[model samples]
Target: MDRQAPRAGFTDVDRESDPRFYIRCLDAQHASAFKQRYKRRTFDLLELRPGQRVLDVGCGTGQDALALAAAVAPDGRVVGLDFSRTMIDEARGRSRGKALPVAFVRGDVHHLAFADDAFDRCRADRTFQHLPEPRQALAEMVRVTAPGGIVLIVEPDHESRLFDSPYPDVSRRFFAFRNSSLRQPGVAHQLYALFKEFGLTEVAVEPLTEIATEYASIAHVAQFEGGMRIAQRYGVVTEEEADAWLAHLAEADRTGRFFHAFTYFITTGRKPA
Candidate 1:
């Protein structure tokens, strides 16, 4: 699928202005589960060593930040930055008196406030899709990373999925719905070129395949439906279309043929020494 035209950066309004019920709906629809999956991938993608200073751009809730600190023990620091105060507050609350040397700051990814060559490594996961200018954020990452330091980026390829369902149409619609909400199209496909343009050498892209069979249940389908309803409230899609599409998937899932597999892009690049 073609990438959509780039739009404005993600605002707190988009995340917090949902109707109360809509937000509740999303909470019930696997947000925590999604985050758990993301955390695992982030930890795997970030290869940390002791005494290595790291920066986590768009570090929501700071779970990955904490993990990175643990990996780089005894003299390393992990600086977590995000645009949301609420998220930063929660991260700090969790880290209070931990003595891990993890610091949470409120900041924007597009224009980071840090000295050049300040970090031994930088990472961003699932955060690039929402940015209006991903390249700008990436360049900032490159600027802050030490010479020969690694920059790892990970994002899900929503347009590409493998599903085993009694109803093939449901799987097709699922893929379409996911692509519609992204700020840019084909983000997974463009990683290599973007890294090259930013002068990052020795770039490597690894695609992760996910296989989850539990998605075939009625409960899971309802959870996804709830999230779609909230997405419509945010103008990501029309209410009628989102509702109808979810109903179709619900049916397929009830029939016990539910399986969905999507690939994630894990691209690593290094700034020249």
Candidate 2:
């Protein structure tokens, strides 16, 4: 696959066009201990049963799909789909040498290539924020799931992101700049209502919170740098201001005062029988 140009800023870039960067971000997310814990909670909420058919939309590198395969072992199967062929290729590569019932395909969530009621369960994680039409994606997920089957959606409310810094103005500018890049920075908080509006039953929402007192624990090293660079690019902050803000964060980390917290919502509903 041909490599795409490096992103000029944090503004929405087609992840499919930059597979390497997308893969790196996925790797960083997998390496975070807090993120792993949250994923486990999501899996538990899925309540997988043996011999079930599952679909993981925007499965990325198949980490979660592999786990889902293990849960539905023996007779069950999982089909991991992504719009990026590179991501699908990476997911297939990762599944090698494992005797699991998992398959990867390149496809779009807005127009799933599956028959109605084709899956026992369906899920999409951290994907809705980037979509300009999240409701359409949710409708497709619901359409593909069997009646009484579950459809799970997980997404972060970027507007709720918070970081501890002495310079309140800088922090505000940083978050505003970051949120501007997302199509729906506050979609997670609206998922429950969306599900209900789509006529799904038993809709429920849960907030998964992460509090990082240490800079490393928050996995903000790259994020901080990226946000500042984007802020500067978008004229939200000056280069000098960005540098000073980063310096303050570094000092806080060294002094054991660094803090960050964000909450993501996991919303699930069942197709009416």
lDDT of 1 by residue, 19-76 (tens): 2333243235335465467556666656778899999987766767888988887799
lDDT of 2 by residue, 1-273 (tens): 212223332123244456578777788788987679878888988899999999998898899999999999989999998877777889999999999999999888989999999999999888788777889999899999999999999987778888888888989877876676567789999999999998999899999887888887654434687768767877788899999999999998999988888898999998999
Give the worst 10-residue stretch by lDDT in candidate 1.
1-10
TM, every model: 0.77, 0.90
lDDT of model 2, residue 113: 96
lDDT of model number 2: 0.84
The parts of candidate 2 lying over 4 Å away from their true place are 1-18, 219-222
lDDT against the true structure, each candidate: 0.72, 0.84
TM-score of 1: 0.77
Q: After superposition, how far is residue 23 of candidate 2 from its true place, in Å?
A: 1.4
- Residue 67 C-alpha lDDT in model 1: 82
For all candidates, the clash counts are 2, 0
Residue pair clashes in candidate 1: 3-185, 4-185
Window of ten residues with lowest summed lDDT in model 2: 1-10
